[model samples]
Target: MDWFYGPMVQMHALLAWCSVGLFLVRGLGHQFGGAWVMDERLRTLVFSSHLLIVISGISLWGALHHDPLYEPWMTAKFIALGVYFAVGHWALGRGEFRVIGYLLALLALGYVAAVSVTRQVLLGL
Candidate 1:
């Protein structure tokens, strides 16, 4: 792989880990009877991180297109990211939908964890 691809993948990997951390903080804040963790700055950070993660992840997937088992995780990551972003948007919006958004965020975290473990998502698809 070229230097750019390696670093790009590395950045995505790092962002994935950072997202996990952010999700955890958000979850803990909610679970422990605190405020929403993705308030303003954290929300912006999460948004940027998520966007970059997706972009970098896609680039990494393209770089590994020749490989057989390189797509499953990418597809799953995309779906997971979609949910995460949607839920986060709603959660930060206001009103009764906030709780549902929080729940979705938790599910999003679970999906992220799955992606991390599986490392291959779009198999045969």
Candidate 2:
């Protein structure tokens, strides 16, 4: 298992960025009246990418052996993940609030990145 850590980390990071990029593309395309954004194939790809991201994240968590209950940063990341998912749902939906939701989702992603890097629940504050 020790030898698996490096590759797993790389895989998880790559999948995370890929998911975000796909979301950005979909959101922008939908906003700009691109019907292709709603294509079944593309939706499936996005769904698959997100599923992989979650799977890889859990794998990494298990590999690291970090207890989330004892790690404030992990707890923060979990909360931010929930926010990202909820806002992402709204962002990809039909409504005037879509723009706001999109931006908020991005913000939540940024917070997750920050916490991941700094391991600080409070971040800059």
Candidate 3:
């Protein structure tokens, strides 16, 4: 399955990084009072990417045959993904607290990326 799995994994990784930037753009646009139309465009892009991201992620998960019940790293990766999404959503909100959310989202995104690369909960240390 290398032919299929390889591209699936690559697509998932690319989308994950794109997601980080999308949240940053949306958050900064909201915090800085950027044009509403532009913000909407970014929002739409983010929303549209979600389906593709899910597809790629699920494909990778199946390709790896990850059993969260037995694999701690896999479980942690899933949890980190949830945290990333929650923080991104919070960051997209319009309020004084959105700045904090935006910053937290970046940290969460980093955690997700690290886990994906290391395949470890604590960087295998």
Candidate 4:
């Protein structure tokens, strides 16, 4: 299990970054009128990557024996993750709200990243 921790962390981090990168590409492409952005294969890849990210995150949490209920930073990250999902849904959907939703999703992601690094619910404060 100890050896699993290191690899799990790496995998989770990689998947997280990959997920964000895919979202950025799709979001930008869709915004810029790239028809390929709506391709089923690309959407499938994005979905698969996100699924892997969640799986790896849960594995890491279990390996670390983390209790999110008692960990403020973990709790904060969970909340931000929810916000990311909600806003991300709208961001990727068809509507004039897409741009605003995309920006909000990025902000939520930033908050999650900051909390993960600093382990602070209030970030710099």
Candidate 5:
């Protein structure tokens, strides 16, 4: 059971990193070259990564259910992720609002990374 759980945890970590990577690349592409880059493709990739990130995150949370620190950070992270998803989807329409949505997504990603590392919510701590 321990061996199985360990590998599952590792897989979750890998997926989380991949999600962050995809989000970073997609966000940077839009920021740096929205005019030249294929906005639709990058947008699609970002949306896909968001789904992957959420799934991997949930798996990781399930694996760490016994840990005392897991619940709080996981809840906070999900709320942040939800806001990010909403912003991204909303921005798909209005051209001017897209930049704001991208910025919010970046902030949400930053929050995810920080919570993942520290395993503590700043507001809570």
Candidate 6:
């Protein structure tokens, strides 16, 4: 966990959280018709960062030689990631489902953070 590993992981973590802000912007901008938020370039940038998020996650996983499939917290976080992607898709689309997607994305963000902090898949337990 030296410079290459530690710094990259930290950078990716920062990127992930920043992406969360972009997620909020994209979702909220839908209601406000914010030009930058609705821009294709913004969407592309945000989506592209997801690739980094995945790559960093895998890199860290490999660095630790950790198997997420057998790890309950990691498993749950992955599940939440899936939900976030699905909901984010809907959130990016047009029509009534956007609201649902927006709320779910927010919840998923919180869930991911909580899981990471608590090291617990089941939050209350």
Q: Worst 10-residue stretch by lDDT in candidate 5?
A: 88-97
TM-score of each: 0.63, 0.93, 0.87, 0.93, 0.66, 0.88
Which tens-of-lDDT digit does each residue in 63-121 have in candidate 2?
A: 78988899999999999999999999888888887989999999999999899888999
- What does the lDDT read for residue 78 in candidate 4? 95
Question: Residue 23 of candidate 5: its Cα lDDT?
Answer: 60
Q: Which ten residues in a row have the lowest lDDT in candidate 6?
A: 30-39
Top candidate when judged by lDDT against the true structure: 2
lDDT-better candidate, 1 vs 2: 2
Candidate achieving higher TM-score, 3 or 6: 6
Give me the runs in candidate 3 sitting further than 4 Å from their true place: 37-39
Candidate 3 C-alpha lDDT tens digits along 1-125: 97998788888778877876776666677778776625567668887788789888887778788888998777887887788778777776665687888788788778777887887889778
- For 53-107, candidate 6 gives per-residue lDDT tens digits of 8888888888887777777898899889889888888877777768888899889
Off by over 4 Å in 2: none
Candidate 5 Cα errors over 4 Å, as ranges: 32-52, 66-70, 91-93, 123-125
**CA lDDT of 27 in candidate 2?**
83
Off by over 4 Å in 1: 2-7, 26-43, 66-73, 120-125
RMSD of every prediction = 4.5, 1.3, 1.8, 1.2, 3.8, 1.7
Candidate numbers, best lDDT first, in rank order: 2, 4, 6, 3, 1, 5
- Compared with the true structure, the alpha-carbon lDDT of candidate 6 equals 0.83
Worst 10 residues of 4 by lDDT: 25-34
Error of 2 at 37 (Å): 1.4
Task: Look at candidate 1 and tell me the lDDT of residue 74.
Answer: 55
Each model's lDDT comes to 0.71, 0.89, 0.78, 0.88, 0.67, 0.83
For residues 29-103, write the lDDT of model 5, one tens digit per residue: 666655634567765765676576567656666665645355687677767778867775544334676778877
For model 3, what is the error of residue 12's alpha carbon versus the real structure, in angstroms, after optimal superposition? 1.3
Model 1 global lDDT (CA atoms, 0 to 1)? 0.71
